[model samples]
Target chain A: MSPLAALSAAVRLEVVRLATVRSSAVLLALAAAAGAAGAAALCALAERADIGRSGLLEAVTGGSASGLSVVGIAAALAGALVAAGDARHGAERTALVLVPRRGALLTARTVVVAGWSAALAVASLLAAVAVVVLWPQQQLVAASPGPVVLAAPLLGYVGLVVLHGVAGLALTALLRSAVAAVSLVVAWPLVLEPLLGSVLPPSRWGAVLEGLLPAAAASRLVAAPPVAAGTPWLVGSAVAGGALLAAVSALVLLAAVRGARRDA
Target chain B: MIEALALSKRHGSRPALDDVSFTVPDGVLAALVGPAGAGKSTVLRLAVGLDRGSGAVLFDGEPYSRLPRPAHAVGVVLDPRALHPGRTARGHLRSLAAGAGVPRRRVDEVLEQAGVTGARRSRPQHFRRGAALRLAVAGALLGHPRTLLLDDPLTDLDDDSRAWLLDLLRVHADGGGSVLITASRAADVLAVADELVVLRRGRLAARGPASDLVAGLKAGVLVRASDPGLLAGAILRWGGDVEPCDDGALVVTGLDMAAVGEVARAEGVAVHELSRRTADLDAALLSLELPETELLPGANPGAVPGASAVPA
Candidate 1:
């Protein structure tokens, strides 16, 4: 078979395999639920505190504040879980044994993960829109989703998921164990990212450097407008995060290819 | 034909395969018999390009690395446990079928051939070792590859599965396909192999027809008699090498079973037991162990003695 055909086959198989797992289904369900709930709760809290006489809170929550956190967490989890799956199931070896072309295999997996993450991102966004439209807030000025706002969050989510997925893959490749990779994935944003952010300077350059961090890049997608004074910092942080993730992914992919070639 | 020329591989200053060289001709089943950690798996991996080594693995007339869709030319079942646990047997086969460019119907055909048709829908995680091996074989057969390189395919198989695999490989070789298998259970599998490549400590010990290698070894018949001392002298007088066994018997070398029996009979020695003992692959492997050698960088490791070296 041609390399493209082989890659397509590998991707299809990976998607089917990932979909069959109980963890994947549970994670997706939890993400949808959490995103909806977060959006709703935020909207309610904003309604209760009538200091802001605007529909901005409703728009931020996508109708319900409950879904925002859920969407973020779920998308992040999906990326991490897919990366861990390869090492956990020993499918990485099988994939390498078949293709032996590390680049093609990584490309296929990236496509699959990105496709899944994009689909879920859109679904969460739509759910937020639906919840907002159904809400009984007549005073809230529900602005239609314009091109910039829509594209920003969607692209942002894509970038976040890609960063997480690449990190997950790199960790798994370096560690050669799924549990260890997942543990690092969990610990990085929760512990390391916060610690690093606090120590780093609060300048535009600092934001750029922080953007290289996974958590900072992911936060860029959720930071709503009332434009903060440090907008450049946030944007820099997002770009840095993407660049760091891409660089790390390339390294991990190279290592994985070398390892597979060294031993079966 | 599959050729591994001057192939050498090392792991962190320790050599795993050292200057190993051998050729498996088309239409013949060859067995690489060696002890554990003798680089058997490494050889298989390098042959299929799953592992990088300082040497060359050529399929038919060209290097395997240059082949387009290598699976069509070389079918490999390196690790039986490498299958994804989440996939069912059928799903696994179908996925490989799609990749190998085989018809979907061949999936069922291979399943039936492998005796895994009944478990087609069962998840691979639920399979026993034999079932897993059968599935692996089915995957290797998907594209009807001309060469099958199996590493310890019979490691955890039952008698029936082993026999079935042997017969299957025999048929594959008979149909003009080359089969190179690595196994420690040489006596069982080597019986069907046309040639035996004996390896010891990452070096080729012996490479020739199975019968020739077995017969060439210092082997003979074990003759049991009431008076072992007399039989030993008689065999020695007849220009045969004989040694006394623990149980009042003489292990004679350089003579066939019939010759030993006839000599004992003529010497008025009553023989209780007389059995032919040939040197097995394991014994041959042990007899020819070599000291480890550091692999030179960018050298053709598998180049046979005096063979022209290919630039690494």
Candidate 2:
């Protein structure tokens, strides 16, 4: 078979394997719950406290658009399990045997897992939309987003989710342990990246580092809520964050090639 | 054909395999036999490029990694237990089948061929060891590769399953495929191999036709008499090592039937039964160019091949 055909088959197999696992079902349920809770909280706050349009968007979008909270964490977990599951279950031995070329095998896994994570983000977005239409949060907002205006952040949220997941998968491959990979991903925006973002001066160094943070990019895509509407660095952080996501993807592909040669 | 040349594998500071070289010719099945730690499994792993090792393993004279579709050239079953527990037998084969660009229907075909029936929809964890082995073997056959690298494929097989698998392997070989199996039991697998590669202490002990290795294996005759003790004593005095059996017969090692009869005739001892007994697989291996006296005595405990029953 040609390399392209082999790669296509591998991706198909990986996608099916990930979808059939019991954990995927549980993950979907958890994502749904997170989306529902985020929407409900946003709707309640919009009606009671009068937060406005961006607040309503953030509420319905959940922290997913910002690359923080449930959606991003769920996406990261999904990515980590794609790799960590194989190692933990000893399926790596079988997988390597089947594909033989470690680089191809890793590449297939990255594409499939990242694709699934992005799809999950879309699902969460759809759930958020249902809540917006059902709960009537328009009265609290002065102005709502047009379809064109809304599409940018929706696409951005999907990109952020993919980045979070791909990063998780790559880190899992690097560490060869799911727990370590997931911990690093989970703790990043929750503690480390945000802490660093806050402590560092709002200068070039901070801008560079913030761009590297997926959650910051995702947060910028959501444009933060009315809670912190006056934050001045939104556009800079979003641009940097998106570029950082692309950079990490290249790094993952390179690492996969280098790692397979050494370890396979 | 599967050819592994001067392959060397190391784990930490210890060498798992050293200059291991052999070939499973096309249209033939070969067995790698040794006690535990003999590196039988290592050879299969290195052959399929599952483990990093020095040297080259070629499938049909091309490196497994170089094959456009390695699965089509080589199908490997490294560990039966290594199968994903949550995946049904069909699910497991489906994923691998896709990677090989095989039609989805081929999964059902392999499951049928491997003797895995209705259990295809159930998780492998619920299957018996034999069932799981068949599922694993079915997965290996998914690509219809010309070469199969199996790691202890008969580990948990029963007598009927063993015969069935032997037939399947023979058919694979007959159809012009190469079968390279890592095995510990000499009796079961030795009978199936087109050739035998004996490993001892992670080194090549011997490699030749199975028929040639079994040549020096027959050690003595089993004789049942009216007075087995008396006959045993006479045989012992005549330089034969005798072990009394539960059936009141003597298993005479080191003496042929003609000599045994002569001794019986001289002693006026009447023999009820006389038959020759060939050495078993382990004895055949040990006595290959070695003295016949080292037959491991009576009843080699823990004698199962491919198991970790190494001599201390």
Candidate 3:
């Protein structure tokens, strides 16, 4: 068969394998819960403030962005778990045997991680919308967003979520252990990168370093002010974040594929 | 046919497998016997393209990586516990089936064939070792591969499970499939293996048909006769070696079991008990004359045209 056929089979295998994992389901549920809670809190705040259509729409957008931060963590963890699960169970031996071509197998895993993250992003968005509409706040419920206004932020959140997941998958594949990947994923963004930023003197280079950091780029995509929806700043942040995300993810993924070939 | 061509692997300067070549023709159940650290598992990993080495392994003339559908060409079981702890037996097999692009129904077929159908819904960590092994084999068989490469599959199996697995392999080989399994002990695979490939210290020690390699190993019979002295005398006169056992039995060699029976009848020596002794058969299969640490010096590591070996 052609190489594409083999890769297609491997992708189907990964999809089936991930579907049976109970932990992935739990993580997805957690993303939904986090999303709903974030949206509900923002909707309640908008209702109490007696905001108008644009303000309510901005509140909903901000809330979804807030929810995505936690969803990003969940997505990362899900990707790490999926990438390292077979190794943790010593099942990579059989996986390598069945799929022979390590490149195809690793690529299949990367595709599945991206697909799952997208799914988690959609679920989180749907849950957030449910809470916003079904919430008891009348004023917030009445402020439905224009299709483009809503689609822009939601699309941004989905792209960022996929980026987080693929990055996690590549890191875990390179490390070959979930624990090591998890430690780095948590520490690099929350502790190490922030600490580096703090140690740097306030300068132009410092600002560039901050912008280049993954957490900073990712946050820019979703950390827009409540009044900033559909504005140029939101669009600019999305463009920068999307570019960095693509570049960094490609580098990590290439490294992961190369590592898998040699390690096997 | 499975052709392992000049397979060599080096872990740094130390060789794990050195220029080892052998073949298991179609419809043969072959055993690769070696002591621990003899590179049996390494050979298997290299065979399936799971490890990079100097040489190539071909399943029906194509390398494992080049197979149109590798899983359907060669099924490998390198570890029985190579399973996710939380994945149910059915789920594991289904995943393999998906990887092999086989129908989902093949999963059930293999689970039933491996005799783990009742435990299909249960996770493998909760299974007994033999049952877990069966589950792994079931996963391998999902593609109905023409060749099977199993590593130390007979280790730690109970009598019934061992018998069942041997029967399963026999049936597979009987149906024109190639079966290759590694074992630390020759006795494990002796009865079922049509061919043998012996490795010692990362080198090929011997490779030939099981019976040819076992030639010149003496086969004897034990008999407890009412007239022990008479039977001994007759067997000795017949040029068969006879030895008196402490248990009042005669150990007769150089004669078949039937010959011993006929001699007893002719001499009017009433035989109380008679049985064939396979004490040497085990040793013969493993070529026990060589010391455990002894490497086969100047041994031909390449494929032999026919049945030829160094005193095996």
Report the poorest 10 consecutive residues by lDDT, candidate 2 chain B.
B301-310
- In model 3, the runs with Cα more than 4 Å from the true position are A43-68, A138-147, A199-206, A225-235, A247-251, A254-258, A261-263, B218-307, B310-312
DockQ of candidate 2 is 0.49
Candidate 2: list runs displaced more than 4 Å.
A136-142, A194-214, A224-238, A250-258, A261-264, B221-252, B256-278, B283-312
lDDT for model 1 = 0.67
The chain B TM-scores of all candidates, as shown, are 0.80, 0.80, 0.76
lDDT of 2 by residue, B207-261 (tens): 7677765654445688988878788888889998887878898888778889898
- The B-chain TM-score of model 2 reads 0.80
By summed lDDT, the worst window of 10 consecutive residues in model 2 chain A runs over: A224-233
**For candidate 3, lDDT tens digit of each residue in B1-312?**
999888899888999998889989999999998778888989998888778898888899998888888888887888888778767889888888888899999888998998988999998887877998888888888778899999999999988788988998999999999999999887778788999898877777777787755553455799999989989999999989887889999888889899999999999999999999865544543443356333233231122324445332
lDDT of 2 at B195: 83
Flag the better candidate by TM-score, 2 or 3. Answer: 2
Kindly report the root-mean-square deviation of model 1 from the true structure over all alpha carbons.
6.1
Q: Is candidate 2 or candidate 3 better by DockQ?
A: 3
Q: Give per-residue CA lDDT, model 3, range A106-145, as digits (tens).
A: 7888789889999887787788778777877456645655
What does candidate 1's lDDT look like per residue over B1-312, in tens digits? 988899898888888888888899989999987788888988887776666679987899777656676667888887787766666788877767765556789999999988899999888887788889999999888877899989898887888888889999999999999999998866766579998776766776556677655554455688898678888888989989886767677778878888888888889989999998665545545544433231121121221222122221
Interface RMSD value for candidate 1, one decimal? 3.2
lDDT of each: 0.67, 0.74, 0.76
Could you say which candidate leads in TM-score?
2
